[model samples]
Target: MSRASRLLTLLQMLRGKSRPVTAATLASELEVSERTLYRDIAELTALGAPIYGEAGIGYVLRSGLFLPPLMLNADETEAVVLGLRYVDQRGDEELSKAAADAMAKIAAVLAPRPRTHCAIRPCCPARRATASPTTRCRSMCSARRSAFRPRC
Candidate 1:
């Protein structure tokens, strides 16, 4: 299997476990060397996967905002496609590239037939904005901040 496929499989294995799994066990299951497994873990972490742990200790894949079990139906898959599509269109170069990578990861798990349900449109984005994503993300917190103000 390709490195990409192997990495996805590795991720699946990690997800199946609730506790940390040693490198030797993972390497044995993946049919790869311990050295290569370490590298793959690093690569996944770099790609924004919430993988944690060290060399001898083993690794664990923690659930984060965007990662569910990936047991998505066609409609759900379409929704993810639409949202990531928006990120691709309006985000800056780095953001756009990250979005592309994320899209690829989503695709890796979904079958081609289900993906056909999604509308892959190169749709236009609204006029470019000066604000960075970080700034825009902070702006989204304003509504909640007032609601959760300190109870002094």
Candidate 2:
């Protein structure tokens, strides 16, 4: 597997454990040399992955810390870009700015070639006569909130 895949797997292993796992154990499980494991760990930390540990003690990903190298498919990326563009066009000034900032953050993590896919473009449907921009924004926000709400 690729180094990036190995790093992601290592992160998953660290996240699964409640207590520190020794370097020997991790290296054994990952099928990599102790030195390679150490180097991988260092790279992950440098990327702000919230991994915490020392050489002998092993590592742990901090609870509730979400780091991104978010893997999104082309379709998913398009959907996100389109949604952000819609928000930028229809949301109020502050909300529009926030959406633009969010798009930038997402673009920063994407590969150079794929980053072009996120360029702002018109994606909003034709506006209704009665609903103002703010109204449209609120409607979109409410729809998203409801769609993502946890179901028991």
Candidate 3:
């Protein structure tokens, strides 16, 4: 992965941990040497990430720190939009609302251009060609359907 992606992954991993994580474990998870992990952690610290720890001891992220999106490109954003849309279409009542809520969260974090693209009409990436017969919602709907939502 690119350094930016690696750094983002590191931040995510650290954020997910409730307790301090060892340098060895974090390095292994990142597929980088402990040296590299140290340097990256230093960089993150310089960048104002509230990571605290020593060499032998584990590192921990301070509670309630917020990190911005580093590398969600347009295509990836579109794919996320599509996946959420699919969930909205096929999921039950609670799940569908959850999907909507998740999309709102995504949009809130996204940059202006991609956020607009994901929130508007062009968000859904469903295609008729990729739809499978078994996913049909009802017999009366239609023979052909979009990859996600059932459509006539």
Candidate 4:
């Protein structure tokens, strides 16, 4: 794995544990040497990971330390893209525009691989036909204005 990916994995591992984790156990899980694990811990600490420990002892991540912005996984990226697309298709003009803006923000943070995943079209079936003909309702329709009473 790339150094960046490894660092992320290390942070995840540390975050998963409540108690201190020994260096040998961490190295075994990460498939790295004890020395390498120590170096990685040092680097993570320098980068403000809040990892606290010493050699021969164990390391523990302090509670409530938020990590940096994380890259979205393929599934998460796809879900966001699909949800935004649905909103753009079915929502009001202002809501559609908001969805578009949200999509752009998500795209800005994605790497090339996850971006490609996001581009894949989601398989949403077309809306079913209603039993009777329907007229478009106003944004705020009252019982006095229309046959349908607005549910408060």
Q: Write model 3 residue lDDT over 115-136, tens digit each, in one string.
A: 5544444233334555566543
Give the per-residue lDDT of model 4 (tens digit) for 41-121. Answer: 999989888899976779988644553333888657755776677677788999987876676555534665665543444
Best by TM-score: 3
Please, what are the lDDT tens digits per residue for candidate 1 over residues 21-124? 99999999999998999899999989998899975777988744336435688657755775676678888999987777677566545554654433355433
How accurate locally is residue 137 in candidate 2, as Cα lDDT from 0 to 100? 81
List TM-scores for all candidates, in order. Answer: 0.44, 0.43, 0.45, 0.43
- Model 2 ranges with Cα > 4 A deviation: 67-152
Q: How accurate is candidate 1 locally (lDDT)?
A: 0.70
lDDT of 2 by residue, 13-97 (tens): 7765657888899999999998999999899989878888876776877754554455787767776877887788899999997
Candidate 2 has a TM-score of 0.43
Better of 1 and 2 by TM-score: 1
Native-to-model Cα distance after best TM-score fit, residue 71 in candidate 3, in Å: 23
Question: How good is model 3 by TM-score?
Answer: 0.45
Against the reference, the lDDT scores of all candidates come to 0.70, 0.74, 0.70, 0.66
Instruction: Quote the lDDT for 150 in model 1.
Output: 31
Candidate scoring better on TM-score of 3 and 4 = 3
